[model samples]
Target: MTSRFERGVTYAILALFTVTSLTPVLGILSTAFGRQSSLDTGFSLPDGLNWGNFADAWSRAHFGTYLMNSVLVTAAVVTATCVLAVLAAYAFAVMRFPGSTVLFYLFLAGLTLPQEALIVPLYFDLRHWGLTDTYWALILPQTAQSLAFAVFWMRAYFRGSPRAVIEAARIDGASSWTTLWRILVPMGRPAISTMVVIVFMWTWNEFLLALVMVSDEAHRTVPLGLAFFQGQHSSDTVLLAAASVLIALPVVIVYVLLQRRFIEGMLSGATKE
Candidate 1:
C-alpha cells in the first residue's frame, strides 16, 4: 500500500544521513594517511597513503596496551551485564516472588541515576576495598551502569514471549532453568545480541569511569589512552587521526560482524511477541 514517492523520500533521507555520518570518517581516514608535513585537515585527500602513520601511532602511543586493557574490561563488563541481566530479567518477567515488583522497580531506578552522581561515592567504596587501579575498577562499575538498561531490554523480550510456548515447556515437565537456557535463550538470540553490541560499545568507549577509577597507566582503556595521546600529539593531525582510527576500529568491526542480527533485533520491536 505504500506509494513510490514515500519510498523515494525514505531512501533519500537515509542516503543523506549515510553521507553525513561517513563524511567525518572519510575525513579522518584522509588525514590519517596524509604526509606528516602536510597541513590539510577535514575531507581533503592525502598526498599519499602513508601507512607509516598507523605504525607510528601504535608504537609511540602504546595503543597495544591500552587496546588490551579495553578488551578485557569491555569483555568482562558485557559478559557480566548480559548474564546477570538475563537472569534478573527472566525472574522479573516470569517468576512470581515476594517483593518482585519492588525489586524490579529498584533495578529500574538505577537507570534514572546518572553516573556522575554516583562516580565519586563509587570510587571511594572501590578504593576502600583496594580495587582501584585494577580491571575490577573498570569492569564492576560499567557492568552495574549497564545492568539497568540490559534488564529492562531483556525483560520486555521475555515478557512478550508467547505464554502458550512457556506453558508447553512447563507441561513437558521442564524446569525453569531448563526452559530458560534450552528454549527461551535460543529464541532470544537477536535481543541478546543487540544487548551485547550496545554494552560492548558503551564499555569500550567509557572514559570518566576509567579516569576516576584507575590511575595506573597499565589499566587505561582506549578512550583514556586516546585522551592522553591527544594531549601529547595535539599538533600532529596525521598521528592523531591514526590513533583515533585505531581506537574506533574494534567497535566498527564488532558492529559489522553483528549487523544482521542487530538489524533484525531493531526491526522486530523489543516488545514484539
Candidate 2:
C-alpha cells in the first residue's frame, strides 16, 4: 500500500542521487578529452573529444607495467581470498566446534580495523620479515583484509543454505570436502561469483596498502602507480583524467561482465527456494 506522493518523492530522491553521482564521472570524461589550455573543472559542451589523451597518458605514465602488477596482485588476492573465505565461511556456517565462534568473530573484527590504523605497524612487521617492497607485501595484506569481509558476507549465504541438503550429501557417503565442492559450492555459485567480483574491485582499488608496503617502482599497484603519475602530471589535467580512466577501466569491465551474476547473487540471498 504505497501512495503516489511517496512514490514520486522516492523516485525524485533516486534521480537526484543518480545525477549527483554521474556529475563527477561526466566531469572526468570531459577533462580527459579537454585541451591542455583549458582550466575548467566540468565538462564543456563545445569542447571536442580528444582521443589522443589516452595514448599520451599510457606512454607517459608507464601504465602497462603498473597495470600488469595490479592484475597479478588482484588475481592472487582474489583467488586466495575466495578460497580462504569459502572454506572459513563454510566451517563457521555449518560446522560446530569448540572456539569456532570465537575464531570467526576474530576474523570479523578485522573488518572493523581500518588500514590506516594497521598500516604503520604492518610496515614494521613486514620490514622485520623482509616482506616489504615485494609483491607478496601487496598480495598478502590485501588478501587478509578481503578475506575478513568475504568470510562475513559469504557466511550469511552459506548459513541460509538448506540443512536438509547438507544432511543428504553426508548420507550419500560424501565427505565434508566432497559435499562442499559438489553440493554447497554449486549451489553457492551466485554468492561465490559476487564475492570474487567484489574482492577484485577492492584489491584493484587498494592504495594505502600498496603505497606503504611497496617502495619499489616495479612492485607498485595501479592505484599507487596512478598516484605517482598524478604527482608528476599534475599540470596535465587531460592526461591525468585519461590515466584515471585507464586505471579504472579493468574494474569497470569486470563489473559489467559479472553484473548479472552479482544482481542474482544479491537477490538469491533474499529469496529461498
Candidate 3:
C-alpha cells in the first residue's frame, strides 16, 4: 500500500514536469493556428482559427522544395548512420581482433569532439572536393556526426546481449557478417529504434551545419529554411507561426508512430542498470 502511494506520487510529479516542459511548445502550437489579433490576446485557444496561414506559408516560402531537400538529406543521413554504426558496433562487440579496444575507444572519442572544432576543416575538405553547396556536403557531414552516437548505442546493446547465442551461431559456421545480419541486428530493434529517434531529432534540428554547408536556397533544410523564412517574412508573424507548425509536424508524427519502440528501448537500456 505504501509503495503504491509512492508510485502514484512520483507519477504525479512527472506529469507536472511534462506539462511544464510542454507549455512553450503548446504556446507555439496555439499561436500557429491563431489569428494575428490573438498575439496580444491572453493565453487561450484562438477566437478564430486560421487555416489559410499554413497554406500561405507553404506557398510563399517555397517550403515544398525545402521539404524535399530535407527529406532527401535526412533519409541519407539516417540510413548511412544506422548501417555503418551497426556494422562497426557488431565488430567491436563480438569480433576478436587486435587493437579492438583501442579502436572502440577511438570511436568513443568522437562523441566528445565538438562540431565547431571540425567545422573549419570540414568546410575546406568539402570545398576541395567541389562538394560545397551540394547535398553531399550536408548529408556527408551530418552522417559522420551522427555515427559516433549510433555506434555507442549499438555497442552497448550488443554488449548486453547473450554470449551463448553468438557462440552458437559461430558454431554453426556463421561468418561475422552473417551473424551480425542474421542474429544481432534482428534482435537489436530496440537499440535501432532509439538510434532512429535520436538521429532524426538531431538531423531535423540541425541548423548550423545546414546553414554553413548548404549555400543554395533550394538545398536548405527545414531549420535553415525557417531562418530564411524569418528573414523574408520578418513582419508576417502569422506566416512565420504557421511555417513553424509545419516544420515541427514531421517530427511529431514520427514520434507518435514510433513512440512505443522508443520508450521500450530507453526503458530497456535503463533496465540493465
Per-residue lDDT of candidate 2, residues 3-53 (tens digit): 999999999999999999999999888888887677775767427878888
Clashes by residue pair, model 2: none
Better of 1 and 3 by lDDT: 1
Off by over 4 Å in 3: 1-5, 270-273
RMSD of 2: 1.7
RMSD of each: 1.1, 1.7, 2.0
Candidate-wise lDDT, in order:
0.92, 0.87, 0.85
Candidates sorted by lDDT, best first: 1, 2, 3
TM-score of each: 0.97, 0.94, 0.93
**By TM-score, highest first, what's the ranking?**
1, 2, 3
Please tell me which predicted candidate would have the highest lDDT against the true structure.
1
Please report, as a residue range, the 10-residue window in candidate 3 with the lowest summed lDDT. Answer: 35-44
Per-residue alpha-carbon lDDT of candidate 1 for residues 1-273, written as tens digits (9 for 90 to 100) = 889999999999999999998999999999999998888988888878899999999999999999999998888899999899999999999999999999999999999999999999999999999999999998888888899999999999999899898999999999999989999999989999899999999999899999898788999988999999999999999999999999999999999999888888878865557
- At residue 239, give the lDDT of candidate 2: 85
List model 3 lDDT by residue over 1-273, tens digit each: 469889999999999999999887877767777776544422568767789879988998888999998889889999999999988988888777999999888888989999999998899999999999999999999998898888888888888888888899999999888988898787877779888988998998899888788888878988898998899878766678789889989998888888888898998981122
Model 3, residue pairs in steric clash: none
